[model samples]
Each structure stands twice: as structure tokens, then as C-alpha cells.
Target: MTSSSPLHILVIEDNPDLAANVCDFLEAKGHAVDVAGDGLTGLHLAVTQNYDAIVLDIVLPGMDGLTLCRKFREEAMRTTPVLMLTARDALDDRVAGLECGADDYVLKPFALRELEARLKALVRRASSAVTPSVLRVGDLEYDPALIRVRRGTRTITLPPIPLKLLETLMRAAPRVVRREELERAVWGDAPPDSDALRAHLHVVRAAIDGAGEPPLIHTLRGVGYRMMAPDAL
Candidate 1:
């Protein structure tokens, strides 16, 4: 079955020929594709960017698919579906792939049409699953889909930068988000000068924790930031 809308996909394969074929096929089917030749680069892109699904090769340079998938789930806390590609058809390999967080598996030398269908199915299932529509830290609530932020009964207006900062912080509430992680999430690979994050953070802090409100956002000097109810501190 063909996808109803375009999907943004990442292909993490070390083989030049296979990577090119998969990318070309997916693009021809109206999907946006990003390629990473090795596992390190793949993990970086997977964590920093939003993707509908990922096509990962089991064996990769720098790091293997299983390790990257585990880190993506455990360290990054992302729920993106992963469909692993491997030449091995052994039951142990399949089980290992699943145990490491792959949602589906495809043996290499497989049909291109089948690969596309599997990727589409994974995206469909993930999209249909229920997830928290809004993210919150104490009184601060962010509706990402609606592009709205509210603190208690007050509707907070924020510029794009501050809004992104707020959402990132809220998503990782009660857990300190590293400054570099914040920068990458907002600006991707081309982060501006170091002071840019500090300036935008000030904006977020002021807008989110106004007068008389127990400050929800906290900064750890030389470290990073986190958002949580004051009582939890």
C-alpha cells in the first residue's frame, strides 16, 4: 500500500550501493530521506532531528545498529519506530534486533517494495498510537501540535525561539537537559554563538515563571537546565 502523505525517513547503512538504492526508492515514492554512512552519524541525526521512521542496518561502522538503537531508546528517550536491515536470517539475530528496540526486521537482499511497505506500516502504527498531546511542568503546559503555551489560566505568548526552548525543557522535566542537547534540538548542527542559548533561556524563564509563581524552571550553573514543580526540588 502507498503512503497517503510524505514521510521523513533516515537510512543508516554503511554500504554505498544499498544506501543509495533505498534512498532513491523512498524518495521516488514521495518521502524525504536523510542518509548517514555510519552508526555514529546515524545516532546523531536520529537524536537531533525528527523522523517518521528509521531504516537501520544491523552492521554499521563506528557503532552497530543494536547499540545505537539502545542508546536512542534509553539515553535519548525517543520512541521512533526502527526497521532493521540485516543479511543474517538467524533466529538469534532477529531476537537480538528486537530486544535492542527494533520494531521490525527485514533480511537484506529483500524486495524494495516490501521494504517500503514495512516502513509505511511502522509509521502508520506509531502515528495511530496514543501519546500525551500536551507536555507540562507544573502549571506550565505546552500544546506542541497547537503551537500554544499556557501557564495556569494565563495564555503565554512567546517567540519561536523561546517557544522551542520551553517545549524542550518541558519534555525533559525533572531531568537536567544539557546545554548542547538544547542547542542541537533547537538549532541542529549550526548552533550559533554560545551566548545565544543563554539569552533565549532568559526569555523562557521570564515568560514561564512570572511574579508570585514558584519558579518551574531551574538552572544549574555550568551544567544545564530543568523544569519541575518547586515542591519536587
Candidate 2:
């Protein structure tokens, strides 16, 4: 297999030896790895840095991994995929972890091979689905690759989550994108709540439509949302 792009991985495990071992193994596989002994520090790193994936332990100090994951989603609005690690093998724990925003889970005592495979699958899926380059909705444009946005001659700068939300909408321009779809696109499979989508939409509207050229992003009542040129109507 062709080596994929180096993925930045954050490991939040309290066990010093295990954490170091996992990090070392991932780094040896060409991934850039960072280790945090506590959930709070891991959350901070995850929010501030653009990590390809996170390996989080359920039992942690300062903050538990589940709470950290939820907090990260709520506060930073980050959509980075997470693989939750847990010593508990109960089905309820697994379900709860998934509900909390974990894309995948690996029970403790997992083989290194299993961990590597899960990480690879997560990263590959993330990399293949969307090109984080640019998004276009008629004359309006946002180039994530360049970290810039433009409507005609004017350029705009947006904070990360709002930009991500706008990009998701722009990618589905002219089509009514369902609320659930938007949540999965911008926040991953495990989303906060239904209201979160509305809040982000408001921010997107203010930034993209408030200027008054012509609103491109539109809500389709109960259906979802769409972005299209005003002339297209």
C-alpha cells in the first residue's frame, strides 16, 4: 500500500508506559504523534491544533475522555474523528462512547495491529471524503486550502468552525441538505443536539448573507438548507 499522508494523532492515556508505547508505535508508522496524560490537556491540544485523529482513553484525570470529547465538540466545534479507548468491555460503555462522538472504539488489551488498522481506516475515510481545499457557491467562494473567502472582489476571514459549516453548505449548493447530514458533515457522526445545527446556520448566514449582495444560503423549512446564486431562483 502507498504510504498515506502523515496523520497528526493525539493520544490521551494516563498510563505513562502504555501511552509512550502507543505514541512510539504510531510515530514509527510515519504518523506525527502527541501524548497527553490528562483529558484536559488533550482537549486543549485537540482544539488548538488540526489533528487528523485522536485516541482517547475513557478513564482519565482532570476530565474523563467522554466529557472531554463532548466539551471539544461543544466548545471548539471541531469535527476531527476520534477513536475511544476503554478498559471496560461492556456494550453500554461502547454505545455511550460512540454517542459521545467516538468514530471508532478499541477495547483495552487490543493488539497493536488492531489499533493500527482502526487508525488507518479512520484517517483514510477522513482523507478520502473531502478535499479541504476550496468551496464554491456560485460567485461566492471559500478556499480552505488558501484559508480565504471571497465574494466578487471582497475577501473574508472566518473562524474555523463557521468556515467549516460554510464549506459544508457550499459543497451541497443548490440542493437541500438535511440537518442530520449537515451535522455529520461538520461535526461527525456524534453530534451535540439538533439546536447546534441551527446556531451554526445563524453564524453562517450573518457572515455570508448579511453583506446584502444576495443570499446564497437558504433554509428549506423542515427539509434542510441550500446555497445557490440569487439569479438561480
Candidate 3:
């Protein structure tokens, strides 16, 4: 799988030893690697460069991994595939990481094989073809291709992950999209807990509904979500 166009990887870890070790391993596997010792630097590199994948550590000096991921999406408008590395194995931590836009997670003290496998999977998914370009519900329209969302004549700019989530919801508009289904669509098979789905939904809601329209993404409390015009309900 090592080709002339080697995969570019960014390792964002505060621990110099761990970062160097991971970089050495990935480099040995015929990949190009860059290391960032702090969250802020890592975020800057991630946004500025076009990396095939990112290995992100949860704990850092300036900013945490979760906050860094959110900031990258919200501020920098980055959409790189992220693999979160953390010692905290709690479900909540996992959910928080994924909700903030990480694509995969590996617990600390993990084997190199597991980390490599997760990295390959994340990159593979990221390289796959995305959903269609545009989605519509009632009079509102969202273009995943252009990354511009429109309600009536007004256009809104949404971050990448939220736009993807909104596209998934709008594709199944007027129908109840199960929580697990949405998770699979956005985060793949190894998604975090259900709370992560809710968190992303909250972000999406703020983007769509904050503009003075009825809520199109509705929760069924326990079942799932439905995209319907406010007037319809």
C-alpha cells in the first residue's frame, strides 16, 4: 500500500517521546509524518496543511484535543480525518471527542497494530465519496458541495461536520432517521455513544434554527429525528 504518494499524517501530542515514537512507526510504514507538541500548534498545522490523517492526543498543554477539534471545525473550517488518542477510556470522554468532530478513538497504552488499523480505517472512510451535493426540506436548501445553506433567499455558512449531519437529516426529510443510522452515516461503524449524536444535533440546530425559522430537525425523545418544516408540525 505504500506508493509514491505516501499518506501525510499529523501527530498532535504533548508528550515528545510518544509523538516521536508514533512518528517513527508511521514513517517506517512509508508515510510522511509531522509532529505538533501542543494543541494550538497541532490545530494550526491541521488547518494549514492537507493531511491524509491526524493522530490527536486528548490531553495537551494549551488546549485539549476535544476543544481543538471543535475549534478546527468552527473556526478554521477544517475537515481532516482525526484519530483521537487518550488514556481516558470512559464512554463520556469517547462521546465528547467524537461529538467534537474526531473520526476515531484509541485508548492509551494501546498496541501499535490497533493504532495503525484505526488510522487506516479513518483515512479510508475520509477518502470515500461523500453524499450528494445538495439537500432540501420545504423551502430550505443545503449544498454539501458548495457548503452553503439557504433558507428562502438567505444563505448560511455551516461547518463541515454539521453540514454533513444536516445533509443526512434532510435526505430523509419527513421520515424518522434512527439515531444509530445517523451515527453510522456520519461517524461510521465505531461511533461514540448516543449522547454524541445529540451534541451534533444541537450544533446543527443552532446553525439551522438560529436564523429565525421553525426547527426542522426534531427529536422523537427516544426514537430518532425527523426533518419537517415548523409549520407542518
For candidate 3, lDDT tens digit of each residue in 116-221?
Answer: 7667766665565665557788778976655578888877654445666788889888899998889888667766544556655666776678777777778898
lDDT of 1 by residue, 1-233 (tens): 23588889999999999999999998998999999999999999999999999999989999999999889987997878798898986666765666566766777788898888777766765554223479977777888776678889988755445666787888888999999999887666656445556656766776778657899988888898988887888
- Residue pairs with colliding backbones in model 1 are none
Q: Candidate 1 regions off by >4 Å?
A: 129-233
Per-residue lDDT tens digits for candidate 2, residues 49-158, read: 98888999999999999899888776787878788888886666765665565666777787776787777666665555346667777789887667689988878645
lDDT of each: 0.80, 0.76, 0.77
Q: Residue 4 deviation, candidate 1, in Å?
A: 1.3
Runs in model 3 with CA error above 4 Å?
A: 1-6, 24-30, 47-49, 62-79, 83-122, 131-133, 152-161
Top candidate on lDDT is 1
Candidate 1 colliding pairs, count: 0
lDDT of 1 at 224: 88
Worst 10 residues of 2 by lDDT: 191-200
